[model samples]
Target chain A: MSDDELARKQRRRRNIAIGLGVAGFVLIVYLVTILRMQANLAAGP
Target chain B: MRHKPGMRQPVAISSMSAPDVAGPQDYFDLLKPRVMSLVVFTAAVGMVAAVADGARVPFGLALASLFAIAVGAGASGALNMWWDADIDSVMARTVGRPVPRGVVPRAEAAAFGGFLSALSVALLALSSNYVAAALLAFTIFFYLVIYSMWLKRSTPQNIVIGGAAGALPPVVAWAAVTGTAPVEAWILFAIIFLWTPPHFWALALYRDGDYARAGVPMMPNVAGRAATKRQIFAYSVVLAVAGLAPYFVGMAGPFYLAVAAALGGVFVYLAFKTLRSGDEDKASAKQLFAFSIIHLFAIFAAVLIEDLVALHV
Candidate 1:
């Protein structure tokens, strides 16, 4: 690949990695919220 | 060197660089220190009240838990600045904020928020009950995700509902010592929750143009000034009643009852003034906005003072 093409490909990969990282972070948050709500419900008044 | 027909230009690297070199004050601004101060004070009140009520929280652990809660509040502020930089840039009141001025990079703000979030929750868990730590974590998540990302852009009721996150600090502090939230703690929560709408809507009334320019769906922008004023009045009335609830519930004494009644009366009066005043001047709106802050702080201070006085008597 030409130098410019290689740089473009590298940028694409970085963007994809960032996107996946955000997705994973969001997944963890969702799981935590779900667990807390369940626990609060179980300990209900 | 022909480009594809539909290709978009890549973002310039220099454009992504921090726009202005920030001083220490910029970092302080990132915390929204005024708002954080209220969170810290109210949380501390909750902690002291819990202890006064016969909960035996160790001094060291309580101090650590308070610090963690403060950091959590700061983290939420930072994340808010990060997400709302665009809107902040356009609003006169928020134009000088660190992120909007580019004194802080958005990514750095996000990373700072994430780091503080993790540290706060971990420290809370280690020093206090896991339930408190978990509540703190959820508060951060609710403010940053639900309030900032979703509700803020989607609806005018954002502040009304999102206020729950701010209201949770006292409950979390109570749980830190007692290992559970009680009816009294939630009454405190409800007071703050109901108080938020009138407080925020007053500011929204004055900053309606800014919100409209920034495309934020603040009540005044989406629902018109008259409707927003009426809602503010309604919420102020509800908040006044809720503020008086602690005294009725036997959680507070005569001093608290007197202070709450006086403040709530003034607040409702201010709300009514704002409703009656012409939208052209905006003076009443501004007055109500300033008084709302004092109203909340004074009420909390009264609670602390009343509790101490009751103990002495």
Candidate 2:
């Protein structure tokens, strides 16, 4: 691959990685909150 | 073409050097953390105020909810900055902001804000309820679309209307806690909403030239300073009454009433002083603007403390 093509591929990969990281972080937060709230509700007052 | 023996070959170099990678702090700055802190504080107060006597959530969950509130508020700020970056660049007071200073590109700001807006609201729903989640979404929309995109450049009533979006955080928190909004929740909303005009108009009074240059229809720029001051005085009277309403309605105690009365008087007095002054009294305008911030903080602090004490006793 040419240097330009390699650079473009690297940039695209970096963006996708960043996007996935953010998505994963948000997913974990939501899961933790859901589990915690469910446990609280199950504890019954 | 043959180069001379001493001449070096010209190398192909990329014209675009590396763009500065935004650090965590830059993203945080895009959130306008200062304003977010105040919103979070008020939202916490709203939560505390909404709780029935002796009712408590799991401490960890409560903390998570507060974090969500802060993130939602920050999302609104980021969206506001993204939309206002054009005007922000022109205004002297806002020229050094991340978006305007090129620390965060406008598209990046919008995308980050959009992502946070969804993430914060969705998390809030998981932690709280759909009512609160929906309110958060509406607040974001009001701020970004109604206020920033339309009313801001078009009308002198921009801040007056835009204030609703800023004021909704506390209401959203209250709804999150109670699962249903009460009249008291809206009373908190009213205090912030009513407080907005005088607070922002005081700023407009001093920053008239900046507003004029930026072509933003701030009250003092659209109307004369005299008219703006009259409106400020009018709003100050209404705000003082609204600020003290929680105590009158039995949400706060006598001590809060006294504190509110005293500070409210000082607030009105400052606005009055600014109004009565000649055209050149930027100091008086500045004083009113400074005191207005303190007035809100003091009133809300009293409410939070009074409610917490009430809960214990």
Candidate 3:
């Protein structure tokens, strides 16, 4: 209803988006590590 | 406008000073998603072409590397926006960008760009190989430091030499997959590099006033429109030849060659039309500008499709 309220809402939404982005990055790193290990194992020692 | 008992006082919405709170979309806009999409597409085509050439790249790794490349490209876009915000604020085409519009601050853009550049390069190295990482770093540096900060203001030939940054995504992806950038990869790069001048000069022809106002030395602002048209036609001739090089080098099949040749022919024809158009007529330049986007996209898409069919079907 007001400028202050709108600003707060935007900030809250931005924080949530950032949280999700960080979580996504962590998931990607985990998946990449697993995939790389599998490839290395398939290639043999 | 009078306040009654138990009623709130009227507040003028226009006079209300809105706080500077940027949403995630503003930050995403800083990344220049359009350019990121182009980078991802061309890089994927490069990876697929390499795969077709017998370079064994796992699908997941390819996807991860592509993500890194996209982020790296976005980082460059952010940094460019950060540096060019002043000029961008005056240009009609760029005035709506995040930094220029005040949705995002320039310093924040620079920091965000710097952080993403490092993270993307590291991710590429970790997920793929060092060569890809190095190429991504170089691309970011070239776009930010060389093109945006220096050449962009100093020379009319800015986009000509600066096109290398835009052209390197495919080469980087090829190196990511094969650990070496072969001639085929450079042919892809050459196609894009040659396409840049004609593509941008056409836009400059119509937007010379915007460029002149921003004090940027776009071809039409530095050289007259006639000379810019001549250069566009000249570059279009070479681009047509470069577009067909993938076939001669055996990187693509007959279907690709046919599509490329047809698209290249039309590209040159449009450039010729633009060249012959009267000085005050921007219609031809506008048509050429619009077609150049399709020309580049279709050529790459044709190569990608042919390679994909060869690999799967």
Candidate 4:
């Protein structure tokens, strides 16, 4: 592949990695929130 | 140069060039995964000890805090490698590191480290208390800026005080659970802090040429091997005392006390052996280096087991 092609490919991979990392972080936050709410509900005052 | 027997031979790299492609493993290596694992284990032990000491934190939150602490540790490692790439390139032991070997560019490594440092600290703050996050931030700054950038090149006592960065994980972990570090947490920090000199000085005694060639003023490189050996023995004695602090302070139980005493005795024995050996005895230093890792692991493992048993009772 051409140098420009390689650069574009690298950029695409970088964007994909960033997208996945952000998504994973969001998922962790969501899971933690749900788990915490579940615990509170189970406690039932 | 004639190295002592049983030393691992470093690959003779005559030339260095950038790879055509930087793979996932290269990036992962940038994190210094082995060092990260040790940090994670010690931080986890600290967190578990805090829980045993009556700090209430949700399991999920604790897990998240541990993750962030591990990342923060890795971030420091990456930043260290990035900043030390120049010297790392010259040192035989570090010549094959990702940046020095051109698997990862210095700029990319620095940016990666910077990004991870921010992300880890922010994640910690969101998951746990701001105190833990702030401590983690300080750890990254202290390791990268203070230790790696400044003291490493300037002082023979670089690892002496710079060890504070490594020793802070337990304190940060304790603060994550309690939102404040009690004396017990600081005791754990003290054990690791005192333990650091002997642990590293042993390695430095053997790798004296690397520090000299790289222009990094390690204790052995600056103060001579005999002085470094004496200092290592001195630190080991204090470390042995600090190792018993968990039991004396009532943070750890009798089970941990017994294990700590045994391991601390062995550590002192090894350090003494390193000190008493002839200048040519790289073997003693290597033994101390190897056993120092085992001592830390066993002490922390004992603490975790004791804490778990307490919870069961």
Task: Give each model a TM-score.
Answer: 0.81, 0.86, 0.94, 0.89
Evaluating just chain A, the predictions reach TM-scores of 0.80, 0.88, 0.94, 0.84
**DockQ scores of all models, one per candidate:** 0.03, 0.15, 0.73, 0.24
lDDT of 2 by residue, B213-255 (tens): 6777888877889999999999998998898899777788888
Lowest lDDT 10-residue stretch of candidate 3 chain B: B7-16
**lDDT-based ranking, best first?**
3, 4, 1, 2
What residue pairs clash in candidate 2, if any at all? Answer: none
RMSD of each: 10.3, 9.8, 8.4, 5.4
CAPRI-wise, candidate 4 is acceptable
Provide the TM-score, chain A, model 2: 0.88
lDDT per residue (tens digit) for residues B1-313 in model 1? 1122332222212222332454455665788998899999999888877876778765656877887899899999999988777667767788778777666788988887888789789768766779999999999999999998888877899999899999999999999889999998898899899999999889988878777766778998889899999999999999999999988988887889999999999999999999899756389999999999999999999988877776577
Off by over 4 Å in 3: B1-18
Evaluated at residue B277, the lDDT of candidate 1 is 91
| Poorly placed runs, candidate 4 (over 4 Å) | A1-18, A35-45, B1-19
lDDT of 1 at B163: 95
Q: How good is chain A of candidate 3, measured by TM-score?
A: 0.94
lDDT of 2 at B263: 86
Question: What lDDT does candidate 4 reach at residue B97?
Answer: 81
Better of 2 and 3 by TM-score: 3
Ranking by TM-score: 3, 4, 2, 1
